[model samples]
Target: MTVPAATEGTANRPAPRQNKRNKPTGVDILVLVLTIVGAIAIAFPFLLILINSFKSPADYNSTGPLSFPGSLYLDGIVNFWERVNFPEKLWNSIWISGTVAVFAVVISVLNAFAIGIGRIRGNTWVVLAFLLANLLPQEALLYPLYNMFKAVGLYNNPWSVVIIFTVIQSAFGTYLLASVFGTFPKEVLEAAALDGASRWTTLWRVIVPISRPTLSVLLIFFFIWTWNEFLIPLTFLVDNSTQTVPVAISVLQGDRLMDVTTTSASALLGVIPTLIFFLIFQRTLTRGITAGAVK
Candidate 1:
């Protein structure tokens, strides 16, 4: 049992390499270039706004909209902040959006838990109804909602906005959370049941802890949606003092139509909260989206 020297040498030699084929092709390069160009094009307007937000009125008017500012200016933002009564609107938006986020998350989690994990009878039909409701345009429901709120004396109330946004946002939140919870581990739920844990206990202690990523996503979404909502708030909270940031900023535009710098500055200020919120929870948002996609 000894091999010949030539056979031994050949056996010891490395195997021939397989073709490496992971390099980018022309199509991929073209796609990358196009994507970059499209992103820049999309971002161009926002970039212009940001640049103009720091420019003086004279500079903004004298220079091209896309030109650099002669100097950084805070007068526009200061004047806009004072004129718009930013504090009052910011407070109104914070409370309304916060309430909506909390209530929506709670309702959505409960609905999703029952429909997704409990597997209650006729849940499919309920989900179908939600999908249909989601498909309905907001404008279609606006007049009815306005009339109903007016009849109930909620037409000029911040709480009205809170209630309306909570209900509207919860539909989508439940749909998203249901998809995630439906894929939960049945064994874990069964073990909880065998331990004599109540459904409420299991949901609060087990399911909720495991579902934080999805919940974070819903919370951020509801906050941003409510904060940015203009139509509902404008329709209901007609009192300028009670208006949210978006409505107030819009009013600033009409009142100061000639002042582009002030308008741009206010617009930039209005979006800061949402941008900061997303940046803070971006990791959880990514996880939630990936989890949903995988399921």
Candidate 2:
């Protein structure tokens, strides 16, 4: 009797057991139930806004928030759009948010590269100072920032809000990115140096490419945060032309004077742009987050 070497190696081993499917346990069911409930809770307000936005004020008052509209009514949307010059507000939001996201990411990358990759002196203190800056109340800084902008003639300008939020967002971004850069693969950086790449060249050709996923995440967050900002934009962008979608919705609606339907329509309109932006970028957002886990 004879056997091949591979067969001989396996001859003494017992047969492998088949994998069993595990049924859901009590904990699994509980977690799923909680997740569903949480989603509904988060979505409830948006749902109400959507439902009521199309209702006439009279219909809304009569039927309450839960009732379906008998027919789609768009006067609230039309009036609100024309009243606020919604197109201009939308453009303002796009410009400010896009500019802030780009500028903040660049500033963060520079700061993080200096502190983390360059290993600059007193970096710990610098990072701590930035962290503390984040902790300071926006209200506390409001007075000084107002005076500073006024002195510079940036007051009542969108640029004022742009500059303020660019610095603010970059502080947090630097804090976050510095840590990521600290854990960067030293071998990769060393290889670039061996290739006679200068610091600037290495940053653009190596570090920036590898860190792009994280930068994408930061950019999207900055845009959304800048888009939703209320107080700073309200103070700085007082004029209708420079105001953002959020400011337009709040200021033009004049809550006291607005019909309930119009108010709902206004809120829904404000939410729609952010929601659409998120949806468009969601894939990139997800990819950026998961990139670290795999590589």
Model 1, TM vs. native: 0.88
How would you encode candidate 1's per-residue C-alpha lDDT over 112-224 as one tens digit per residue? 99999989899889888777877887778889988998899888988888888888899988887887789899998999999999999999999999888778878988998
In candidate 2, what are the lDDT values of residues 141-203, reduced to their tens digit? 889998999999999898899999999999999999888898889999999999999999999
Error of 1 at 251 (Å): 1.6
Give the alpha-carbon lDDT of every model. 0.87, 0.91
What TM-score fits each model? Answer: 0.88, 0.93
TM-score of 2: 0.93
Q: Candidate 2: lDDT over CA atoms?
A: 0.91
Which ranges of candidate 1 are over 4 A from the true structure? 1-21
User: Best lDDT goes to which candidate?
Assistant: 2
Minimum summed lDDT over a 10-residue window in model 2 is located at: 249-258
